[model samples]
Structures are given as C-alpha cells and as structure tokens.
Target: MARMFRVLGFFTLVIALMSFAGDLTEMSLLFFVQTVVFFLLGYLNFTEKTYILLFWAYMVLSFLGFTYWTVFRMGLPF
Candidate 1:
C-alpha cells in the first residue's frame, strides 16, 4: 500500500509539472487532476477544515501556474 501510494504521488507530481507547461488544450486535464487531489484529500479522516485548506492551497498554486502558461503562450492580455 505504501509503495502504491508513493508511486501515485510520483505520478501526480509529474502530471502537475506537465500541467504547468500545458496550454488551453490541457486545461481540462489540469482540472481533472485538481479534482482528484480534492477527492483524495477529502477521504482523509481529519477535520473538514483541513480539506478546505488543502483544496484552496492547491487551487492557488494551480491558478498561478495556469495563468502563467496562458498569459505567456496565448499573449492575450490587452
């Protein structure tokens, strides 16, 4: 179980890093990954607040990464 969890963590990290480098084509994939992170954290036996905190932190990081990718790749800002 521990080994499986470690492997999954490694996989997620890779995905997250790729997500930082993706364009709009991968936005949905990034969202899916964010959803999975929430799902896994939600299943924890800890407090609900912990889940909320982790989710928000993850969102902040994801938003910054995606925003950076979009702004640089799309060059859409006026």
Candidate 2:
C-alpha cells in the first residue's frame, strides 16, 4: 500500500504539473510530502515494531495535507 501511495502521489504530482490549473507548486509540494510519508509507511509496515505510532502519524499528516491542499486549495468547492 505504501508503494501504491507513492505511485499515486507521483501520478497526481504529474497531473498537477501538466494541468496547470491549480497551484502546481503547492500541489507538487504536498504530493512530495505524501510520497515521503508513503515511503516511511512502507518501511514501518515492514518492520517488527510493537507499535506503529509513526504509521498513524503518517496517516494523519498525509490525509490532512492532501485534503487541505486539494479541497481548499486546488480542487472542487474551494
């Protein structure tokens, strides 16, 4: 799933660049952060830790970042 997230984030980042409707710079930044989060998630997911606290943190950050930037910044009903 983390790999999937990185792939999707990269895809969206490219879309944002080509579309040129939304704030491409901001979109690209958010997607980049998301890609990092996904990479971390992949690492943590594969680890043998007793708790996935970092996983939750990554989830929250990625969710809120994507939503805030996309919805209120670049996407519909902003």
Candidate 3:
C-alpha cells in the first residue's frame, strides 16, 4: 500500500509538471498538493484496508469535484 501511494505520488508529480508546462497554474498547484499528500501518506505506516478506504474516499471526492466544476463552474448551458 505504501508503495502504491508512492507510485501515485510519482504519477501526480508528472501530471503537475505537465500542467505547469501547459500554463495551467491552478491545476498544477492542485496536483502538486496531491503529490505532497501522497508522498506523506506513503511514508506513514497505515494498514492496507485503511489505505484502500483512503483511496476510495479520494476517488469519490475527486469525481464529485470534477463533476461540480464541469457542470456548474464551467457555465455551460444545461
């Protein structure tokens, strides 16, 4: 599980770099924060089930945030 978190942190760091290169500062910052969080979590000694639950919570929150941003923040006609 810790290894998985570190992998995710690496992936997010890549994403953050890409976003920065693309001039998406806000997105870059968001991913940068996530990278830090994942790295921190990776160093912690947590149980596998806890890690799984945390990942699930992250997924749910991210999906909901993305949906909200696309639907409401984007201002597209319904």
Query: Highest lDDT: which candidate?
Result: 3
TM-score of 2: 0.39
What are the lDDT scores of the predictions, listed in order?
0.61, 0.61, 0.98
Off by over 4 Å in 2: 1-23, 46-78
Name the 10 consecutive residues with the lowest summed lDDT in model 3.
Answer: 69-78
Decide which is better by TM-score, 2 or 3: 3
| Per-residue alpha-carbon lDDT of candidate 2 for residues 3-74, written as tens digits (9 for 90 to 100) | 554565567557656545675676666666655655555555454342255556666977997789888879
Q: Residue by residue across 49-68, what tens digits does model 3's lDDT show?
A: 99999999999999999999
Residue 49, model 2: lDDT of: 45
RMSD (Å) per prediction: 8.4, 5.7, 0.9
TM-score for each candidate, following the candidate numbering: 0.48, 0.39, 0.95
Candidate 1 has a TM-score of 0.48
Choose the strongest candidate by TM-score. 3
Window of ten residues with lowest summed lDDT in model 2: 43-52
